[model samples]
Target chain A: MTDRRTIYLDNSATTQVHPEVIDTIQPYLSEKYGNPSSIYHKGREAKEAVEDARKKVADLINAEPEEIIFTGSGTEGNNMALKGIAFANKNRGKHIITTKIEHKSILNSAGWLERNGFDVTYLNVDENGTIDIEQLKKEIRSDTILVSVMFANNEVGTIQPIEEIKDILKNKNIYLHTDAVQTAGKFDLDVKELGIDLLTLSGHKMHATKGIGALYIKKGTKIEPFLHGGGQERNLRSGTENVPEIVGMGKAAEIAKKDLEKNRIHLKKLEKKLKEDIFRKIPELILNGHPEKRLPGNLNISFKYIEGESVVLMLDEKDICVSTGSACTSNSLKPSYVLTAMKKDPVFMHGSIRFSIGAFNTEEDIDTITKTLPEIIKSLRAISPLYNKD
Target chain B: MYSKKVMDHFKNPRNTGEIEDADGIGEVGNPICGDIMKITIKVKDDRIEDIKFKTFGCAAAIATSSMITEIAKGKTLEEAKEISKKDVSCALDGLPPIKEHCSNLASEGLRKAIDDYLMKKKD
Candidate 1:
């Protein structure tokens, strides 16, 4: 195998587990492997660890420890937030409102609620992928029980106006849930300040292991149990705890909270340099998502007349990893709904690529990408039938 | 998820670019659908003397374009027209099921190029 260093720029998809997190989880997997449900010494140790993890995760988002409920994944958290709230408050209302640009988890959950006898309204987004507040105000009805919006988009990294949305739903008895899976570690999330009734966060997105996620539910929020069993997670989510991964996620959250500002500064610097270099070297490209109010590490751009999958493979050949929103990369053979909702041209949608930086990246990595990407784009455009320089 | 052969051809496409003074040219697919192939050929004694292609598509599209040119090079116009999508895909070891359409575009582009030449001669 070639010894070329692999440059991973797909942090938004999932980050590499941090060394500190791995170290923190090692003891739980071996020496302290005990069921949290047991009353024995090992069990108590495991239980204490789980509770400590909950506190760390809760602290990361400025939520109370009791408000944190660990789940299998961000998908599960989203499902629990949507379905739990919907079933419990069916008497209050059967209407739900969400955006068209939400992740599949949120969109699909809304769809499931729709099929199961609920009214749903999908709000449209502007060219920058920001939802309109006036439209939201018109859509919100007395019967509307919950309004779910992602804090930041997964593909485009557009930060939604959650505070304004919260203000609109204030004291209306309508619960607001924000899928903060992308924003959990990158941005400071104040659940009390934002007035978010429910929030979802994924562990793997913030350098923790997969198969672990957390949902923050404000106190006094009435929600039904998503899983019914041995009454784990305060009976809201019932399952034997995944001790190792939970501890890892907790440690990840601790590190994230401690280094949030530093990481954000590093990521913003890298993102700015990368964008500047790419825009300077390339022509006929359009940036996707909000120019200012976006995730620091996310850089989504569409190169005209070239397909994204081709560009991705070309980059991979050089040991650089990135993601694309092109239909060719997906099984559905349809381009990214996020970009489509933004009213991007279908042609440009086919050419969209997302580069998400992480803490592990350095200036050298950015330099390598800046040096290598242009050559790949040049070669691809040379053979592209649609690209005529004249 | 292309075969190694497909990746190889994509990395080093053969007979790329346009034949400025070609006898005929063929273009297939569209940007909306995300795959487009343009082929140009020079005919001599009813045989494809020189062939070139430029593609705007995924890995499968570029590989299939290169594979078709390699398969049809020096073949008579009649033989080149008979080349099927299967021939192009099989020459590249095989494409993914979704990408089989890319091979179809390559063969169709070749046939259209040949048809263009024949149509011009009849006039």
Candidate 2:
């Protein structure tokens, strides 16, 4: 505990809260604690803090402050976007379209709409986790009300063509929503330029506090509120605002905006080096997802004959935390559906590992992984029946 | 990491190819999720003469199936029927929580296929 020699590579899951963000919210947690809904000087201070955070969030996405609505988490934001947009646009269409590789948040949101009398079509992706724009165009019907695809896949890091989606939805009133949880802090994202009508952002994914997120709705977009109560967030979201987290999220957004290019370049360099080393050391490794249409901080590879879960446990013992597509859905029995949808062989699917990098990662960490992974993969593959026996 | 027995079975499994003209067989699991095994057994004179397998599965499934068929070879039908998933996994020196189900399904499939082979012999 005292040594502080830790390497955190699971940035997609979440990040350590920024010290500045913590400082910004400390006073609100202690003396300045007042409900933004209350009418007084202290409450007014809280209200101003909330509004300031709202403005920061909107600024990050290049949207107006009035368009931002604070929510509980990324999942809530996705739900409000999907369900809210679908319910409001039902007079226009009865079908909704999304991809197979969205986060559980968006996937489940689409599922909820399906059960409530709306027909939903889940678009398939190619081996690189890229959806066909033409196929999406063909699927979009007069009855199609919304097209919700994630900006970047959380598991595989495939960047969707949000601009192409925009082009497809140019004339239609169908809203285009994206769950940009993984891409938020890692990439330069502007909702306006991307033509995203509805976008979701999670706080913890970007070094802010957990249990806090926001959704961006275009000025004229009509979305029925999912959580209804007092007129907070323009009567769309109920309950008192978590002023401290909103402030922290705004600070996180500011930090993300300032550090985007530097982190992107650094992580890209590390990614290229790691891939080259992995190819040189373990040449049989196949990189999953799109080659260039992927996140700079994410590297997923499949060691031909070993098991991913075994590699995870071995690396965990060495204090190298990784996941075998270890999503909350089926972290136990199944490999990643994202990889599976990519049409990877079962042998490779069973052997894939996701090594995600973060802001704190260094060249030494990449070197550590490059050095340790090949040996571990070699040992595991040596014992694997697929390699040794067959 | 796994015990040497499990590792060996996984490393150099015996009788891994499929049986084209076998008396009985069973296939279990989906390839997209990893772990698919096709086990085939030949019954002769109330005793299993040959057992073979083909698996597009994880190490544990392939190892456990290879071990089960090894243990079942030349054994009586009733004895092979008594083979359990726990026995298969134990012989391979235990599996991770996730892959253990694959072994269980393999055992269940082996037992079912043998039972089907035996009941057919009665006709």
Candidate 3:
């Protein structure tokens, strides 16, 4: 399995770290290793590198450098944004609004807040996985202090209406936070233009190494600190900085911003070709997510009457990496909540496969998937008791 | 995660496809739960002459289905019914703990096939 040519299509899960990012972070891990909080020359160098990375990450999302707070991962960023705000604004209100299709980080954070006596309203999504603006209007309350939604869905690739939701919350006192973990490098994240107050980003999703993420908090936003350690990240998240991973993320963010257009085009081309080829080859398949307003690199489809985990395993044998929303693949034995929120049938949810392309994927990779997937589906469907050939 | 024997059985499933004149047919599980096993048996002289399975599931389910067919093919109807879910799993070395329920489908389908054969004998 290790010797075969690996075709990695699970980019949305996490991307392969870019070679440039690796090179940029090399010195920080070795000779330049110094605590950012120290007063020595080495410390100053580390501090400068950390600030530079912050500026780069901020620039990627069009936010001020002072607004970015580094955390352990995107999950941490989301926890900081949700719990931090919920606690900081407890005097103002205890009400929070979020969509049902948000990533588990946001949803689970909101759930924690609810358990801690905050009121949370989970808005439902339409069939295409977009939240309803009219429903948001109805759900808004005077005490609603925050409305957190994801920029895009990770499982199905459905991009949400962040700008529209921002527009609705503009005049209101409620702050808006968008979890952009899936959208950071793939789309233009203009926080200012979108009127977003807070946003979450993960490094690994954008070709940087894991274990580093950033949260952009607009100036003057009331948010409690995540950690109460030695003051770092403006005391929002306190701890010794992960210098190398931060530096790598900065380089990754810079590269992502610079090559956004080219990467988008390349990814879209691969996605379109793969979608067309797979649809042509396989019948009785339903493409999940919004058909047009989806991520450029995401292609989620459900092969009817077959379980997704089986297809994933069969594809693995061919050295093709993919993820499935099937219950059998999950620890809790429940299919994807994202798909369930979209009101997809249980059968479709069990059969869903997400093939997320990346900057590294090529037309040949797409061709291999299109060629291999149909045969896998055919074999699995042949054994499926529910599949009836017409 | 599957054992090597489980992978082998999944890759080369024994006695797959429908028997044209299967004396007894049994289906367990459903598409909603993501694992379904259908077993067909040819019974003669109170023994299973042939047994086949078709499954819609993950690796464990298919492997267990294949394993049950191999375990019960030449056994008497009562002996086949005695073959438990654990027996199917043991034949395949072992299944992931999370996938232990998958083996239940194979044993249940086999027992149902026996019951179906007995029901038809009365008719």
Candidate 4:
């Protein structure tokens, strides 16, 4: 932010495609662009590539290759997991449970289910943004067939207790589904250990191209296909496979696994440095998330008397990219629902900003952003008549 | 955070804290929105004599509170009631697109204070 170079701190929105991932998928996109369903030699090659990618992605999540279902994105994967399970197992139960702080994709899907015909319970989150397991237990009904909670929140980056959720629903025969888009590449993902019957992950969140995602269904978990066509993914997904994007996603997962430990440590360093500097330079700034149980790359802060959007704009002037909220909803005048659900005060909500780091970010980038931020805050506070030091 | 203009107001906001035994008081916005402001006014002969505020949230909230008090000082209740969000924003040279609501919160707080004053007289 101090230099002429721009620093990007919004990786939670979507990561840039790693050079290796882009290179690996080039041959499939141009030279070997054959329909995976085609019986010809190139087509068979393309089909085999998709399968190889599938196996790699499965390995990344510790799931069987046969259990994976390809989809358009994380939203589609979420819809399929919720809607498919809701409609298929209707007779077994009409109750579904999710948290109030889930991504809009999951919430919207839940809304659709409620609109058509289904009972849904939205559990509340604590001040720190973690849901209570006991409340979840209270909400679970006899006919509760599905419990779909997210693995991690995109905004606050509070890692949910997915393992505990798995344990809670273990004896009840309720299916546990998690939207792990924010956690797949950044954290260890073991479906069997977590007891997730259905899991969703997006390619773009982990350095793969956008518009490609995967849904992990444990063996013997029957979910009706959300989209029907040529029965491409073992009749579970009917459209022709997205060969290039699928391969890219698989490669991204493999790369993430290979460097996950290193990346985590690096991001943790960045976040630590950021917090130390922000608190040191700014007056009355508060970090908003669980101290230990948070994503390493996510740093959500509440400035005492400044608007998050003005901060973003000020930083943007220095070519430092960050988020007042989600990039998807940055333009919206409404404050983040995640913070609102956390029960943050209105003034604090308007003043909060999220800075998500990524693989490409460097120590210098963090330093520059840290240096540039206090000045911006100081300036906004100066003109901000709302700021009352007295 | 903000430019110099914003920082000045945040660091040294005018008419800060609260005015006890005031003629009128107004509280607007809610915690759900993450910005809340309470404006207290001391008026004599329908003319605002003094103003103070206590706010709990962000720069815009603090700044808006500061600006409203500064704007309302010495002005008649009618003049202060006519103060719009645009006037506050104009005083501060405009805000970021997403922060327009902060200005609105300020206007609402000021209007609410006048309403509280008039309603008390009726009672």
Candidate 5:
């Protein structure tokens, strides 16, 4: 399905790597192919490049460069942060707090922790997918060692109240970690100002190459090494440094930081226009997530009495890429757990479609979607026995 | 991932829409799983003279609906009753493993329609 006219709106899955990032990494892949650990001039060049990338990533999140540990991806970063802290502070406490709307990485890692003799409390989210601060506060206990929440949800694009959460944990002994994969590049995320103890960032979400991400470990936070090897990443994570990908991520981060305002505006404009047009065209269409505190580019909606998978396939035929709430990966035929957690009706959950707009999309792309989608929904609804096409 | 035949059937489905003046009707699957197929049939003596379908599902569900209707039309009720899920999938080249259940719905819907026809004939 390689259509030159394909409009990719699934940015939450991954982003198209920026040309500047590719340009920045070409030399590292070709000429500067030395290992960062080698004790020679070429190695020193590679080491300097890695450290420079570290600084750039740190700058993107407003963390000290020394506190950054490069990992394979956002999943690895989350694993390291949750398991690392859980292992290191096992003696202090074994209780961890998280929200129900976290990505699979956080939920799975928490599940592992729970299976391995640790206690975890999955805080319930409201209808908008935002966790209640009062519930989180009430859930904190003396043995609670860490609290991990996502900065913003990937599916519904609900921005959590991290700043308020920081205030709740300020006087406590617990460490706060956020899987900031979705919010890192799209928004102005300053870990320092947000009082985030640990932050996870994935390169692929920010127009950088995949397979390279960073974990922000605030100095003096108790954490054991999740990965053991040749004692790399300050003995936290050990692997041969991915020089080219690191350089790509660094350039991407620099560009993201510089273009933050412009990108935000562009995404917001597109999201607003698309939502407005779609709402005007389709009645009884339900919007998911927070109205104001959502990702700028996200527009999730449910077309009642129609299946989201059908809509996705129809849109795919039109060369417009989209995603449905139900994961088409496994044959289980289950709807989105995230939507279920928010207490959405089982029938409506199957109809939810997440249209995550990105920096690469144009107004023309939105126009194509807005023009074609209503007709598609109309046809599907006509065939639907539940829908009365009056 | 759907086969080319499946995509073709989905793109241009045969025997679409509802048979308003029908002899028998069958609806299978549910909206909860994001699939619901309603099959309507017109019977002449013991043979299916016409068949139409309306579906609310993904590509596979609609294609299977179309495929089953095409397989059943002009066939004796006894012969149409023999068309299994595997037969419908085979006719569409093959469906994805996950989507094989859609073909099951297709076969089930046809059988229900035939059963409805038999019940009506007795009435």
Candidate 6:
């Protein structure tokens, strides 16, 4: 280590665990390692810790503790919600509705449901990544039993109209599930007010350790258990509890609830300064996602005539970590499907870079990025044959 | 993931620029696929005396381009054309499986430069 500070702006991928959360989880790891399901005194202590963590998570989301089910990760929570709901309510209906821009967890689970004889209606989004409410209402058929949408997009940070979607489905028999993994700790989440019956959240995205997540199922929502064994978590998910991580997640959630507004304001300021500096210095830059409706910390932009992967590598050299929409970083050889869905041109898709800020970011960090980013883009664009100096 | 040699070349790419007085030039890839390379060669006496490349691609693509130029310089046109995709990738130690396609751009760029040379000679 050269004692150089690393600027990590990839919060959408995962966040660094907070020290407070680490302190909260210390006792649970070594001293209180007993399983929550056991009946002994140690087990009782573990169970109390798990319940307390659950209560904290519930309080953050404004839900009953009974409504939350702990899972292995956000992906698992999404799978449980989509597959469990699809299987449990198959008799009542076989159709589902979701947007084209949901996280892969929900989309892949929806694909699995399709293979099992369920019809899924994928609603399209506009240029800003907001789904069409009129189209969503038109697509809901008599056989539609569930509607799934994301609270906010992970790639572009475009927030969906969760409250509007839920209100539209209020009178219907359909159940509404929103994957709130990206939006959970960043904003206020009242399930009743949002009209969301089911929601998913990941620990690592909100300053907690990985491998621990939760799904909120409102009372009266019918869902079958995806995993069957040991009958833990209301028989919905069965596994030995991850005590330390759960405690960490609970602590993270509590801190997030208290610091949501402050973090939001801080990130917004960082984003504004970074964007203004970048736009002033660089030309042919296009911003992605909804302007005002996006996450406070997200700053996605496309630098034309240069590859995003190249920009990412160059930025990495400076110890500033960021992610891109380039196919080189992704499994597929095509540009980001989220950007593609927004009808972005191929050049913009290939050149898109996402700077997902977080609570830890400071104005000086923004200055460091703005100071280094323009030169990186300028140098790459200089060598880019497609770019014209004019 | 990349090999140490790939990282080395990516960190310090050689012969990167446009030879405005070059005898031949070849460009491959488009912005759509997210990788593009333009090679400019200064050939003299049927020998590639100088070669430069400008690439807009991933770490692998840029490294492979740099490696191709290093392999092509001071070689006869026929010898430079014979440089294979495996040769460029092997020069960089090796590329990840997903990035193997980037090497094709490297060799193709050299061959295209040679082709451009022959075509302009015929004209």
RMSD of each: 1.9, 5.5, 1.8, 5.2, 1.9, 1.9
* Model 4 fnat value: 0.26
Query: Candidate 2 chain A vs. true chain A: TM-score?
Result: 0.96
- Alpha-carbon shift of residue B65 in model 6 (angstroms): 1.3
Off by over 4 Å in 2: A1-4, A330-332, B1-33, B36-83, B86-123
Tell me how far the alpha carbon of residue A44 in candidate 6 is from the true structure, in angstroms, after superposition.
1.2
Candidate 6, clashing residue pairs? none
User: Which DockQ values do the candidates obtain, in the order shown?
Assistant: 0.79, 0.20, 0.77, 0.19, 0.59, 0.69
Query: Can you write out model 2's per-residue Cα lDDT over A1-390, one digit (the tens) per residue?
Result: 111365567677777888889999899899989999889999999999999999988888889999999999998999899889888888888899998888877788788778898898888899999987888989989898889998888777889999989998998878899888888777778887888888999999888999899999999998899677888988899899999999999999888888889989888888888788889988577888899999888888888766676677557556777777744554556667777677778778777777787777788888887788877776555444355442
The CA root-mean-square deviation of candidate 1, after full C-alpha superposition on the true structure, stands at: 1.9
Task: List where candidate 5 sits over 4 angstroms from the true fold.
Answer: A1-4, A326-332
Lowest summed lDDT window (length 10), candidate 6 chain A: A325-334
In order, the TM-score of chain B in each prediction is 0.98, 0.88, 0.98, 0.94, 0.98, 0.98
By the lDDT metric, which is better: model 4 or model 5? 5
Docking quality category of candidate 4 according to DockQ thresholds? incorrect
**Residue range A1-390, candidate 6, lDDT tens digits:** 112389988888888889899899999878889999989999999999999999999998999999999989999999988989999999999999998888888889999999999999899999999999999989988889999999998888899998888788888999999999988777899998888889999999999998999999999999999678998888888878899999999999999999988888888898999899899988898999999899888888989888787788888889998999522237666889899899999888888899988888777878888899888888877777777683
Model 4 C-alpha lDDT per residue in residues A165-280, reported as the tens digit of each score:
88788789899999999887688898988888999999999999999999999989868886678889989889888999999999998999889899999999999998888888
- Alpha-carbon error at A246 in model 4, in Å? 0.9
Q: Which 10 successive residues of model 2 chain A have the least lDDT summed?
A: A381-390
Q: For residues A127-208, could you state the per-residue lDDT of candidate 5 as single tens digits?
A: 9989989999999999999999999888889999999999999989899999998886688889889999999999999999
Best of the two (1, 3) by DockQ: 1
Off by over 4 Å in 1: A1-4, A326-329
Provide the lowest-lDDT 10-residue window in model 3 chain A. Answer: A325-334
Cα lDDT of model 1 by residue, A81-156, tens digit = 9999999999999999999988788889999999999999999999999998899999999899999999999899
TM-score of chain A of each: 0.97, 0.96, 0.97, 0.97, 0.97, 0.97
- TM-score to true structure, per model: 0.97, 0.82, 0.98, 0.81, 0.96, 0.97
Which pairs clash in the backbone of model 1?
Answer: none
lDDT per residue, candidate 3, A157-206, as tens digits? 88888888988998898999999998987898999999999999999999
